[model samples]
Target: MSNPAPAEAPTGAGTAPVPHRDTEEPAFPAAADRSQWRYRPRRAFWRSRVVRAVAVVTVLAICALFILGLVREQTGTEGFLVGLGLAVLPVPLLMAAFRWLDRVEPGPWKNLLFAFAWGAFAAALVAILANSFAVRWIATATADPDSADTLGATVIAPVVEESAKAAAILLLFLFRRKHFGGLVDGVVIAGFTATGFAFTENILYLGNAFGEDQEFGSTGLGSVTAATFFVRVVMSPFAHPLFTVLTGIGFGFAALAPRGKRLRRVLLPLAGLLLAMGLHAAWNGSATFGGPLAFYAVYGALMVPAFGLLTWLAVWSRQRELRTISGELPAYAAAGWLSPAEPTALSSMRARQVARAFAARTYGPAAARAVGEYESFATTLAFLRDRARRGTAGPDFPAREQELLHHLWQRREVASPALTYAARATGRVWAPPQYLDYDGYNPYRR
Candidate 1:
């Protein structure tokens, strides 16, 4: 019996029209015979997208400018310049590390950029203002400045800062829910937010240190600037990211929960946020509660171990994503939506790399790009299907699945042969079971 055909794309006010197909064609039509599907989003859709884009950009830009002015006012021009230079050193490295972790099912750069900008400007601005106000209010109430400072750092700062950073994750989780799939996505987005926050924090600290050093006629290695750099930049660059990632993990878990399980969805993120706050408070109180020894003890006993564990969890989650792709795509393969070998090739990072390289070598950069897009769409499709099976998929699942299939179909000519070649080259080729019907019963459904 011939394999069952995949669902046709649904047409609507904003969606593209379904392409015509010959009734006599096979379930998986020949590459040349498959009609190319074009997505022509309606003018209203384009207008709304552009308007939202502009609004977000404008808000971020305004926040950035205000924060820049505030920092400059506090730190002299020269100090700001020095701080900026030093503060930027670890940013690219941190971003690269997070992006690398997200490689399996890479998110759009726009999400990452939004996370970073939100943390660096919007969140930072909120933290600084709210923290200062809280400290002053406590100082006035208690008539003890030092104690107010301590409480602000340990209690007030953690709550405010973590909440501010979490707003970015929360917004994305609600609005860009489709992209916020699982734990790794959470970790990556949280890491980017924390990295950006740390970047701005470092600049302020370093700039103030530089100003102090200038006032005291100190320079070189023995200066306040050097000490600040060594402590904040060299020693604890990952501190903020580690704290924020806990919150991200919480949101990630919540994302995986079925919509009907409302309590699980709410409690998971709250728990994550609480954990993040506790850790942040402990780290901040270290200096006040003890001294340098206490700081080192916390770093070694808590921070380092926490970081390592999260790192392992993130990596394991990425591997599980690949496994999910490998497992879930076979049903589609058996139904002729995908080539028999495509799932195996797409699941292996090495095979994927080889496929892209082969495409570029044979058909140039455009073909390579097509293959990359095809891979992304296929990976997303697998995740979407997995969510559907788990009863966690959103109302848009059918439309989204059809859109992904259309994109995959468009690029199959460039992607399929290269994937097949890479599968054989990498020794990962597999023959999907010929008679499996997903609609009736799927062994791989779980």
Candidate 2:
């Protein structure tokens, strides 16, 4: 240009060429579009094939030991079958309850699988062997087997069983930090672990009850098995989950604690475990205090109130999680990275379901799958941004954010339009005509 003497780049036979002026950058450059970036997945230290294989084998061995121990304790094949059938009745109900609590930010199935397996196998085996040994030793020392049984139930069993179950939660919390984010995560994991423990414990109690009934020539609902079923299965199926949930609350608090609050993080879970042990002791001692009537009294006076309080807290926490998601996502939308209606639509479970349905109806199963994946990634991004704002984000925050953003960008072609239709159908107002005209049609805006 300075050479102006460059003659403005001479024209060809049928073409005209002009001297180049200063080039302005595009508003959305290809380099800035992360969807085009080549993603090199990083290998996690603990996800090595060898480590996973070893973990699988270890869980299997523990499950085998638990099964063998249960058989030995039951003494009859028929009794075991009866216990198995009765004991499984409450599992589905309990699992569904926890799953409902986790609807706001559902954790990975793999994490739940590990929690359940640990509870069913490793925790159960440890509790059984430890409690049996301690009870036998106490009986021999006291020379009073009846008193030993009472002491074992009130003291040794609670300590051993709760500690074993808490171990599983702790392992998952430490290893699966991304999933162990808040109070609901803690509650759900603890619930499943306790459920597994309860399942094994129930089998033992019901089986033994069945054996006693058989020995006494009793049958039908009036039998010892019936009484045990009413007490354990009907009356107090939530007993184990209730106690263990305290420990879970502690872990949940720890998970939300800031990175610098090292002392709080360490103390909270221990406090919870101690509280669980205390509650367990109180419940077990109720029977000794005044027999079954004392059990019923405590159930009404203490346990029921505690359960209601926890249920309310879980529900409240779920609402808070939804609020966080709704509040944080609009910034990205304003920055031209998401559709205007995405934050509101994602905040409502109803809207999400509608979006998925609309996608499936309009664009087939693959599009519906993409919509689901988009919802999950968006939820995760919301949580990550919230953590960053609170100064609790991990070292890899930027990388994780970029990765999630890339995933959302890639799926936006299919998911964004579906979500827009869902929002309109769900009654959210569309963008004004002026705004729409100004923005034009940018399908990849997100």
Task: Give the CA lDDT, 0 to 100, for residue 389 in model 1.
Answer: 70
- Clash totals for all candidate models: 0, 0
Give the lowest summed-lDDT range of ten residues in model 1.
10-19
Q: Give candidate 1's root-mean-square deviation (CA, Å).
A: 7.2
| TM-score of each model, in listed order | 0.88, 0.86
Q: Candidate 2: where is the Cα deviation over 4 Å?
A: 1-50, 428-446
What digit string (tens of lDDT, one per residue) describes model 1 on residues 43-72?
575467678899999999999998878888
**lDDT, candidates in the order shown:** 0.86, 0.81
* TM-score of candidate 1 to 2 decimals: 0.88
* Alpha-carbon RMSD of each model: 7.2, 10.3
